[model samples]
Target: MTRTGSGHPRHSRPGDGQDSRRRRPPPKGRSPRRRRRPPVARTATANGLPSGPRGHWFLVAAGLLVVAAALTLDGYATGVVGETRPGPPAGFASAESAEVRRGGPVVNVTGDRPTSVRLPGRTVALTFNDGPDPEWTPQVLDVLARHGAKATFFVVGSKVARHPDLARRIVAEGHELGNHTYSHADLTAVPGWRLRLESSLTQRALAGATGLHTTLARPPHSPAPPAVTDLQWAAMKELAAEGHLVVLTDLDAEDWSRPGTAEIVASSLPAGGEGAVVTMRDSGGDRRQTVEALDLVLERLKGEDYRAVTVTEAIGMPSAHRRAGAVDRFFGAALNLAQRASETFTGVLRWALFIAGALTLGRFGFFIVLAGVHAHRTRGGTRRRNAVGGWPSPPPVTVIVPAYNEAAGIQATLRSLVATSYRGELEILVVDDGSTDGTANLAAAPGFPGVRVIRRPNGGKPAALNTGIAQASHELLIMVDGDTVFERATIGRLVRRFADPAIGAVSGNTKVGNRRGAIGRWQHIEYVIGFNLDRRAFELLDCMATVPGAVGAFRRSALVALGGVSGDTLAEDTDLTMALCRAGWRVVYEENAVAWTEAPASLGELWRQRYRWCYGTLQAMWKHRRAVVERNPFGRRCLGYLTLFHVLLPLLAPVVDLMAIYAIAVDDPLPVVAAWAGFVLVQGLIGWYALLLDGERASALWILPLQQFVYRQLMYLVVIQSLATALLGVRLRWHGIRREGTFNEFTQAAGRSLPAGGPRRP
Candidate 1:
């Protein structure tokens, strides 16, 4: 087979690059060996940040923070902070003069000086506060309309925004509207800015709901003019400057306490049948008493020939409602839409949290049960050997090590291969894919005479793996990364699985070799708990998705039948494994075949690696999506599980964190904390079990709780970025992590002797 200039082998069909076997001749005049420029050195800032493309994790964090802050504020402003008591603050003193105290409930302080007026004789001003409620307000409105009476409704802006139809209804039914502040914030209790904001927001809500703004202001929890305190007077003056007439109630029905309807009606009646401004509530609690009392009060007043009217009507003042301007209407509509959207988003998040929690728990439980089944079924090699009628003769094997700037650990990889205890002919092939480092020279050094080094131009791991596959001399092949070191019996154990000819591929147990740092330990835990445990379940289900590149064994016939490796996705291993399964080949996990590989040492490196993996998996899933509808277990079991646990659940998992924060803000955090601790404990038990299965120290499970705070969030962000990239159709390249030669330390620590070689590079 001849390769193209791009290092990919030419195929017959465009979309069948991974399936076609008839390779074309090399392009005319293109030399088989071409010199390439040295790869660029990665630069870093003084602060040690990568001087490459910027990361978007900070942006993601900022977005989540903004959402949490909005939720917290919304909860607080919407009665979560609780209403101020219906009395002046302690130590408050009355500031009103005797004349003003004895005057009417309607007071205009916007003039050169404060002035007041009283309702006319036989006229009763019926005013309802903290209303425009969806339930009670309509009943109150119905009663007023039936009795031919018009009342003033002081509407909370938040409620009006939430139930705009009710606000519009209040105005449409010939009822007057008053500004009761956006959250019903007490004027005397809040700061000057908050007081202004509350009033302004209410005006906006009214304008959006009814295309009108109200100048009739009512301070929440305020008493009659006689009880107006100094601080209350100052707030009223500020409202006066903003063109508002403070309306106070002369008669307090106190229906908010749900007092007896008879008592409510008695309190509502004016003293000696004099004209009076009466206050009652249609919202803020059960207002059944207020509703009943309202009908009786109107009936009794009608019998007494005392007409019930609006505040403006009783005081002989102009209508408090004014038509809003275009600007106010536009902004008010926008504000209304935004508030509604925030509320809708919060509701969706709550449901998403519930679903994510359920899915997570279900997946954990399923994995534990199925993995246990796998362990029990394949508990011993004796059963497997007996089923195959005794182990077959060992066959010659080829080991392929694809290297790219892996000079740090390539020799150790070669030495580990040479030291394998397999009783068969073993051939080692190291394909150096245009590495700028002296990786090819290092592999071809005289210390290792059995190893063959194949040099090719840079074409990524898939292309290099194909080159190695084409060059190998044996039928059985084991593929391993240059940074991984296998135990002496690993290759033998991996090859033993081939005794069952039905098995086309075997995935070795890959462990984190450099588990000294926090990042390393986290990766180690993920490997044991996440990858290895899931592989156990996938194996039993016959829907194996990935034979990891760190270490895997395959028959050369399977490779040839599938056109070697495909460069169609960054996760070529996963892509090839899925393709093999779809082609009627079985892939299984061999936990006894252990290989140690280095993990990313920094968060940035880990993010890049996982981002590529996630994005590539998405690509492969889409590429093979047709299998989902085909008559195959790969579709029925593998795709469904990946879609749920890997893609959908991860996308919704962030909602759980956001809900936790919101709960802590508005409600008791003990439940949230307890829920989180319970989840972590479950995960800890699973991690400990995985470690026990893998023969690792359970002490490492201690870091699992802290992983939720940092490592888990990074993984979530990676998934988000990957999904965004896939949705936006952004093409991503395979990103490689820098090698740290950490696997060598693992080998040295295990007292494994290495083949003598030239001095190692620092």
Candidate 2:
């Protein structure tokens, strides 16, 4: 079973690497008609949850919708379904004295129902509805104060809660207080508990603001007493039971309709020398007419020998104001806080939606720009690295494969390395980072004869790589993850780029190996479209952000100059690469060198893995923040680029995702879908181009839209969680993904054609 130095058997064909562009046929005996496995379809919960928090967004939206519906129901019930009290026009009412003298059953509260009070002299009570409004309440109050008149304001509880100072001013100005019910809800239409809350909460707010509780109340939209329906009467009686004085007006001044002042004044005079309770609105829409007509009405009333007074005073009944006790004050404070909290939540949600949309759009625009720039840079083909002279005749290289619970893929990774086609001295060093599995034994097994295994305590990947660097016999080092399987020419291609003396590091192209499932396909698209193209751009600028752990080559002297891999951040590769650039070493990309690595099998695993990567990248960026102030090209472009694209863009990406959720939940879905489709279309074009550049297939683009719905959100969450954790000073331990040796497909396919492979290293 002796195999070639390329790790493939002697009979192996060309294009045997895990290059998706090259499709290999079945071996001599095997059937060429093998059925491809279908993508795995994972089931969702009863609610059809794809991912955990994504489903929770729907729940949140549903809850908000419920709250909004309740508020709408209350508003509609008050405005349309409930009662509207009809008042007599001026010069028409003559029952003022008769009704007062014809009162039935002992009434509890004065002004509870319109009082037909026959005062000692000709007197009229002026009452305003729906007020404490900032614009008009003051004008009405000023007019009343100027004319030496006092009015009763039945204020909406919500309005009072918002403008408590206005409520206080009303009491301070010698005006009477009355409840218009919270949010002006119709008590006759709502349930019993809601009715109670509507009444009581207003009382609490008024008491809290003015230290006086008003027993005077007017059911919203209720008509004059004689005209109230039996149902409205029943509701009024219920309020009476609660000790609320239901104020009904005798004269109707429909100034709320913006009628002329003369008409409003005409509507206010009492008929047949009877004292009437006059009604006008101070708030609830444009009230300029109300404010304007007040002085004219006052003058007319004075001329008619009618002294305008508070409802209680005109009715000769005691004031409804009760000084609030400590308990009442406390209740008022709690009620105010509750209302403010609701308002605050609504405000915050609106701001969040705006911010999310802005960030989402910004990020999309930035990605487009970056992709365009990347395409222009690598338009014809990959530009060569700045290494002094390309390493045409390569030097000896030591490959370090760091493993942590990677027993599943370590052998394949090592075999892939041993089979490299580089004609230089090469050795394999497997650093098992305290894997409880048989990673060490497997590496030292008889099958992998020349492979060297070094065991150490569970120090992280950075520590293990550092150990490998210290122990390596060669000056040229290649670092590979235990789960990554390299192609035969991957090492040679990567090493050749280091020929430029200034080129300190080269990042290799990474491909997703297990593209058998939907998740894998999504990641496959991302690797080809996102990461590889990003490297091409980074390489053009001589500021490669990360020399991926999957496959990268570096000069040992450059590594030592930067003190090897630093454990200060979780993303050692990125940290090291940035450090190299900051230290005046150029880090470039090598697209020809390809390595196949397993993508996470499930969402949970994908989240955990990406969480670590995103978090580490942020930490690394922060550690190198000082680079932003440097004057070099590395600082100007590399640090500036990282700060803008990597740091700022990621932060904004989550907001965009949130805006997407908001749009889907609240706005029209068509525009949202259209915008998203447009973004995806652009993304697909870039991905397809990148795949073509990297010599891979575009078939994986089919899952690009699905990725937007599922994978894109998961990635955004990862970025958000990572940023939050980093900002909050929370440290996350390394989380390893469950690997199932995805490279076995490539190995199985290769083995079918090739003869036995004797492990060969240059």
Candidate 3:
């Protein structure tokens, strides 16, 4: 501490530690002031999120599982009604059972196990061994009376032989009695026939004394003396396979040492799971002490929420009719509960599916509406009427085309551009992104003039665009795909939208260049219905997510303000569009400005493109998540819409779809259908709306269902690869391989389609 003049300690300045003793001089060409770094931001806020109707797929999944479990339980109940259920106490040696079926075929095949099948409730088995002695049995009975606990006694038949009164009391007290054998000898050491004789004698004795037959048997411990062995397990299994479960101890109590009641209770497990078994050791114990401890253990475990039952009832293997009516009631209640669960799941799942389907279909509707608007606006002198309404004129345009291996379509795209009747001005900048083919020379060698070519190492499309933009001599930058060709008035339509000062970007229409094959045709319909309608609705909201890289124009100033085109992400166009809009820039769509691209000719090719697109979209969203919540200067806008469309839907839909598939595979499809039907219906509405909005003739409506059945469903498979790569952080780069020969291949797969032009049949 340093002292002030008043002798009071004061805090030192930040630089006061060690270097305070030295006098340092500033270096040459440096300012005298200490420089400060900008403050680091802790958290970014998302803003400009638009409201949207979206799906909650996770809830749908949990609901389905619940329903499935319920159905399984229900079906089991129905199966139990008339089927012959096995008795827990039946044995081959029992006199009455000697002529009856002692065990089923399965019991003989796989030895019975006393560990009963588990059910998902707090259920427990109460077993008492070496019992039926008069003194202990009566005392145990009184304690059970006090607390309402019932237990199954694995009786030493010899004890019952002496005290038939105690045996009768056990049965009268609503307890189950199973044979521990007459002599209490280890069945493991005895032959099967001898063991059978012992089991028979015990049963005969119990039946004579108590007038009840037992179904369950527990061996001495987790293992038995080699003779009695799993004969008990075998019996339990025999019972369980025939609709019964052999009760086994999941716990141990070691209470036979004459320990205090507190000690016995201390060893007890809290009642849950498949229930716990607390036992009296066979070797040593003051019978009275063991008996007394049983009372407290029962009380405490009951307090811990255990529902005690005799072995038969606990395992659903009751014989001698112990608590049969009550067991039936409990089983009935359980079935009812399962039915209710099934119904509830069906309700929730149906709604969730509806939402998903509806949202998707809605997007399609929006596309159609916008396309219709475009067609109507461009037709019947409407363009001339809106022409002079103070909308900015189409400025001189610079078109930057980045080519990697485009020897095929360079001439076609160039010819289309030269053929344009843009009233004002135009410029084409074809930056070759390090082409291995003759794409650049093809543009230069011919009468193709003014397509500025800047050759750069393989940096990607965004960097090439940036390079071209830097050398451009115009205020409007239109980046057309190297493989796409536009119509004569495409530029005019796109440029005219710039007249609205609020519009920062304008997206054009895109159609499949080739739609001959089944896959391509399906994609064609999907594009028309899903994309066109959606773009218009999005534009109206100023929440347009992606100004597709294929055909879009940007205000040069706005592009510059955003620090030029970025190559940091795969979906650079989407990233830039959202970034600009969130920053208060208005983005619109020009439906008349149509361009075409070669849709994948095969399912494999389509899958690859879609996979990459899905993955790229995710990367861009994550990279710019700051915009998810941060209120841009524009106000709260597309943020919510973007999350719903770009983040949440893709994140959740596949899970629901896949789980539904699994449910159908194992159980009934009713629940699965219930969960997803709402989604499908909503999808249909969207399809219809899209076609309606696009001004598409109802004649083309047939494609709507075809798209839904074929194209829309592809999202499941595509999302799988996207999700895997995102999770595993795999980088994917797809440089489409150019076919070996044919200029027809150029128009078909490499170049853009002219508006309403005959499709190139790839």
Candidate 4:
């Protein structure tokens, strides 16, 4: 063997060997020499993410924990079902018995405790319970003022805290306030100590609102004097010990029942000139009837010579107690803060759920419409076809295969490329990007002819591709990943797409070559469904986002015009394609141009790969965000599509997932499951159609549903991690994947059928 002018080995006769060796070397300054860089030693984590991704994981966990805590607090406060903690009392605890003693308005309960409510004859004390409502409370106050009457309002502490202004207004307008217990929970249903806290909390709320405290209290759920039960008597004794006057209604208006105004007047008038207390609500529901009844009852009471007065005033007691201490003020402030926080968080969650539902439905509708159009166009061939694979004399092409430490798969990839059936002048540039492995040596080995190996420093993938682009000897360039294997007609089919001069780049259909495991099959389904279908739609819209690196065809001038592969993003292919589109060039998808590439076989590998891809895509998007406002077609269509589908949709996807969980646990799980299943079904149908169009089996879609459970979550997490890291301004280094050369293993492990030429490795 003798070395030719191009440094390739050539066969020579024994007599011609000396002459071949003596052939003139390349002219001075014209010879291409391999570029070398010193190897730098670096440490790597277990997951292959440079600088470690653990910090980003921590940030994401912290964020999720915050959201979870907020939701948990909101649930706890609302007496929501399914929560582990005990909820508020179902209703006011059973009523108790109390009697007026020694001709005094004070009531002596059966529990050997003194509770007082002075019931003066004829001068009926008309009191309303459950008040401080924003809307109805104001109307009740106005009626009281119009009649020149004042009544005590038994205000629920929670409502007073929520509407402190109304509570203040009630006092400013001369109507007195009474405690109805914080949250309106039944004291009898809770322990004695809890009952004390409930009363104290209400006193604190009153103090915070009106700068005054009231000892007058009304036990919830007791309509009249005789209705108070034993348990309620015990609770009443407890409140009495705390200096609270338990005011029980004598005449029950039952206005909370929304009974007619006439009945309310009749009930309040009372039969035999006995002073009484009436019960009504100002909040917690529509209170139109309560307000109306109060107006008519007040009018009838005036005609009967009965004047409504505050409970304390009618009972002949102090209207309000002395100013509260520091502890009471602190409790009031804290309760108000918690209530405000709970309300805010609840409102946010409600809106989040609504937005999530809308986005889920919108995504469904958008994809269905776009996919339907894509399928119809595919069936009808509305776009002009660029005939591929039958040219008598195809144009010359150069295939650039960028390799790092891809020694394990490079040989088979090279073999697959050499076997392409295109009858064109084809050259292969194997740019080994500073690999420690024997990739460059193997590519330049005598077994591989016309394969030139160019060595460069480990400047990353984009740099390596640029190196290859600079050294290529042909006008048409096809980029192939070192781990990818192409079909015999793939190159021919790809180059044919460029028959239209406006076509700057063409993306090929890249299928997972190593579909031996569950993970691989899931990716295979995704490639078939998520990616290919979108590409078909994008191609028709002339808004193609990416020309995948696995197997893509490009014109040399177009690539150079965009400054070759961009290093600003890890997704250089996407960046370059978008740049080309923005530069007034067309990017198209060619489904017939098929390449089989090894996908990540493990969850960890898949996460790292997808994280880099998503993060880099985000970087590219931000770098070109200005395109959104541009007037060009690429700006209007491509930028708009990417902004909606890529950026906006991914950001909104997590909300859908969260809503699904919340709905399943807190709302209705079956409908969420049904909706998810419906989405999967539609996606599966789209996948089936895509496979049929690509001449692949639709059976691959069988794993799609399973993907939602495992693979889809992993992808969502990847997107989340990337977004978290990017938002935090954390710079991530390129992480190399630990490839097992699954291409060879897949062929043997599954006993799968090979392409026409059979397995190239073994």
| Highest TM-score scorer | 1
Candidate closer to the true structure by TM-score (higher is better), 1 or 3: 1
Tell me how candidate 1 scores on lDDT: 0.79
Relative to the true structure, candidate 2 reaches a TM of 0.72
| lDDT tens per residue, model 4, 1-762 | 000000011111122121222456677889756567544323224353545445767766676666565565455334342322223333334323434322233354435544455477767676778777888899988988999998888888877777889988888888888888876666667777777877887787777766678877777775454444556666778778877767777667777776777777677676666677776777867788777888887887788888788776776667755677777777777766676676797687678656755765675566556766766764554245434533346889999998888877787777777767777889999988777878888788775667889987666677778888999989899999888877788898898767778888888888876776899888777777668767777777777878888888899998887778877765677778788888888888777788887777788777777877787777777777777787656767766665665555566565566656766887558998998898788777767776776667777777778887788677777777677667766655556566666565533342332274223223
Q: Which ten residues in a row have the lowest lDDT in candidate 1?
A: 1-10
TM-score of each: 0.85, 0.72, 0.55, 0.82
Off by over 4 Å in 3: 1-394, 633-639, 651-685, 695-713, 737-762
Q: Tell how far residue 197 is off in model 2, in angstroms.
A: 0.7
Per-residue alpha-carbon lDDT of candidate 3 for residues 44-136, written as tens digits (9 for 90 to 100): 112101112212234445655655565443332222211222233323353222211332211222332222243235655566777666566
lDDT of 1 by residue, 38-116 (tens): 5443432323233445455566677777677567646745765434545535444444534456666788887666788
| C-alpha lDDT of candidate 2 relative to the true structure | 0.70
Residue 514 of model 4: what lDDT? 70
lDDT of 2 by residue, 356-408 (tens): 55665574556556656756664433454322225545688899988877778
